[model samples]
Target chain A: MNKPPTIVIIDYGCGNLFSIQRALTELDVPSTISRNPDEIAKADKIILPGVGAFGKGMENIRRFGLLEVLGAFVASGRPVLGICLGMQLLMRASHEFGYHEGLHWIPGQVTKLRPGQPGEETVKIPHVGWSPVNFNSNNDGLFHRLQNGTYMYFLHSYFVTTENPMCGIATTTYGNNVFCSACCKENIVGVQFHPEISGPSGLRLLQNFVFLK
Target chain B: MKNRRIIARLDIKGPNLVKGIQFDGNRALGLSEDFAYLYYQEGADEMIFYDTVASLYRRNNLIEFVTAVSKHIFVPLTVSGGIRNVEDVQKILRAGADKVAINTAAIANTSLIKISAEAFGSQCVLAGIEAKRKENGDYEAWVDYGREPTGVNVVEWAQRVVDFGAGEILLTSIDREGTGNGYDLELTARVAQSVPVPVIASGGAGRKSHVLDVIHEGRADAVAVASMFHYYYAKPLQRMYSSTNADGLRLGAQIDEGNLEFLNARYGGILERRFDPISVKGLKSFLAGSGIQCRNM
Candidate 1:
């Protein structure tokens, strides 16, 4: 029998790590949550799941000393998935409370969804609840079997804008703001939505990631 | 416009799913996780697991429950009741809850709203406001699961929590809850208009049209229902629990405790003429047919 692939969910004291681990368990796939560089290096796939502030996320990742480990993992051309703030961390920088740096794996800058103008105050800040993602027909990377315009749960004040158009795989609209909800560049994949908590369609997206070559 | 969220609010006491009239006299329904998974499959936009007696006990004990539910049910989960400090908020979030709703603590120390929002982004903080209509045709904020009345005005408090960094307001009407009359549309409209953050109109939803009225007339961004969905699944869930059904097996694996007495009695011991069962899928389709946007079934 062929050996089962090893999946590692990076744990840096942010985001819901159990849900991601349990989602894979529901799929009958075994995985582990760790910040250990050796374990992460040996894994066939790594999922970077996170929630909370951008500066805190980057700080926690560095505090765990996963910077060089992650950099080497990305450089190895293996599958690396970043979720929510994890996706934001893959960008060049974020302008949340203050300007903060990111991994720059995918060239982009994370900024507030709506910068709050006079009439724009009507547009809600956190952008909570459900919004549909319009998949890029040309490159439907992780969203392979999922239908176009699939509604996914979103809860973040800031969003990512990839410098390269090819990196943008899906777009979602909230009020007047139309931003990228899912993106990928080469071997790196990231989604702004929490697939672990997003139901069956979300499970399918995770399955796609689990089997990616 | 973004899809209007239809959240399944489960009032939990001890380890069982429960429903109450005006936040009083809670009747155990079944297992909370069973109903939560059913709602998720039915295309409910989100789920709220409010520990009904957490405040009275002076601690939020739903961390284990939150961890178990977040595993199988893939949807946004909000844990409410007895969130006293930033550490409590951190613990719940760490347990896999997407958001934490604060009511009694925030009313006592409003700075909790600001500090938690700063500690964890505003998106993770929810301001839970339980409102009761006064004789003077105004509303007052009530805490301790609607037991004690605070002098704070509901409308003004709604705006203040948003300024204090609450991302959303869960507005529950004490006068109309579990009465099946409908939402307090006037109160809902007032808070929805005052706060820029999303206002989730909760309580007193006995029918499908009541949800429509709240969104259109009440101007609420989302609507949460407990009795309507729980009562509908009570009997069927009981049957599956007895048998070795696949869903039952899945539910059994996650939850080790539940109250099956209400299920065994078959709606006989409770108040007579309770609401007829309403499926979450049926409610969403009904809302969609009425031109209201919701996640597709």
Candidate 2:
């Protein structure tokens, strides 16, 4: 059989590295977790998974000299998936813990979800829990096999607002705030929810990412 | 409205999944990982594994199970118990746990919450509050598996932890825990109302209505169930595993741990008269039927 496509899970010392790897393993796909730019350069697909503040995430990405390599990887037209904070890192800039510039892989700003108005059903921050994501008309296969309004687990305080409305592939509502939960531009895709732990729907989403050509 | 969460809380004693009434006399139901996977499959929004004995032992023994369980189930996992410092939090999160719930050390120092939040992020830190109602009708915070009192008012402590950078609160009612009586809604509402972040009401969930009541009345953003969910499967799983002699099907079925002695009197280690088992899926549908939003299967 042809060798399975090489999938690289970028390790910037910022997120849970094993959960996604284990999910891929369950899918019968072998992947590598590396921060080395050389290994990242040779991958068929690359996943940027992060779980922290945007400033700190960018600091680590630059410290490891991954900015140029990641930019080039995106430029190569290979499929790229960014999960949670990793998705926020793909935007032009983030206002989390002071303004920090991102890879600009997609033009967007990562901003905190506005607090719900008083006496109007308070909207919790960190948006913790399982919320439904409504898919747009975009035909990106990342959400293939997943229905609109399918509940996915989300645990982030900030969300991405893309400059181009078409970039938003899926949107989730937490209180009155309906922000872009998933975005795509060219070969790059980003999701605010952690699909690795999102049950069957989540597993299916990852399977869809892997099946993408 | 945002969907409220239904979390499956697995209380671990040694390597076994245990449940106790009023925070004492725990009986082992089965292996921890088995039940965690079962809950995940049943549509649990999240999972929290609390090491019941970790505080006394001064070390969390849940790393192995966290690593094993996280590999199979694709949901956010929270680990609590004996997480005294930032390093402990880092170790648990690195082992694939998405969040860490702290109680004993946070009460002792309070800075652990702020420091861990800064070191990691606010979303990574959860303040575990064990509250017991006093005679004056006020709730006080307890730690070390509800064995010691901190003389701190529960509602005040909830806000304090949030101010200290805790992203969420895991509020357990020691008075209602494992009692099948239901949650302490008054206490849950007091703390939940005071905090801006999400409050997960835990410890007592005897039936479907009790789960509904906590969300509606107590204002809890999430509800964590242990006995109501676990007991539903304990007797059936015991009979199936024992009949097939599938000891290996479980992680460590033969281990003499937890309140196995209490379970020895019964045939399958469960007291059928005490509480009825409710499936996580059943509770979700019931909640949805009652107009409360939950993640649909």
Identify the leading candidate in terms of lDDT: 2
Residue lDDT tens for model 1, A1-213: 555679999999887788898889988889999999999999999999988889999999999999999999999999999999999999999999999999999999999887346776346767887888898755545877888888888888889999998898999988778899999998999999888878888888998898788
Q: How many residue-pair clashes does candidate 1 contain?
A: 2
**Residue B74 error, candidate 2, Å:** 1.2
lDDT of 1 by residue, B64-89 (tens): 99988777778888999999999999
Backbone clashes for every candidate come to 2, 3
Candidate 2 on A1-213: residue-level lDDT in tens? Answer: 756789999999887778899889988888999999999999999999998888989999999999999989999899999999999999999998888999888999998997778777667787888888899864658877788888898988899999999999899988889899999998998999988888899888988888788
Instruction: List the candidates' TM-scores in order.
Output: 0.89, 0.94
- Candidate 2, which segments miss by more than 4 Å at Cα? A138-140, B237-252, B255-274
Roughly what TM-score does model 2 have, to 2 decimal places?
0.94
> Which lDDT tens digits does candidate 2 get at residues B1-297?
778899999999777887778889776667887788788888888999999999999999999989888888888889999999888998998888989999999989989999999888788799999999999999999999999999999988999999999999999999999887888999999988888899999987887889899988999899999888877766554544434244532325554543344444452434565566788888888888999899986
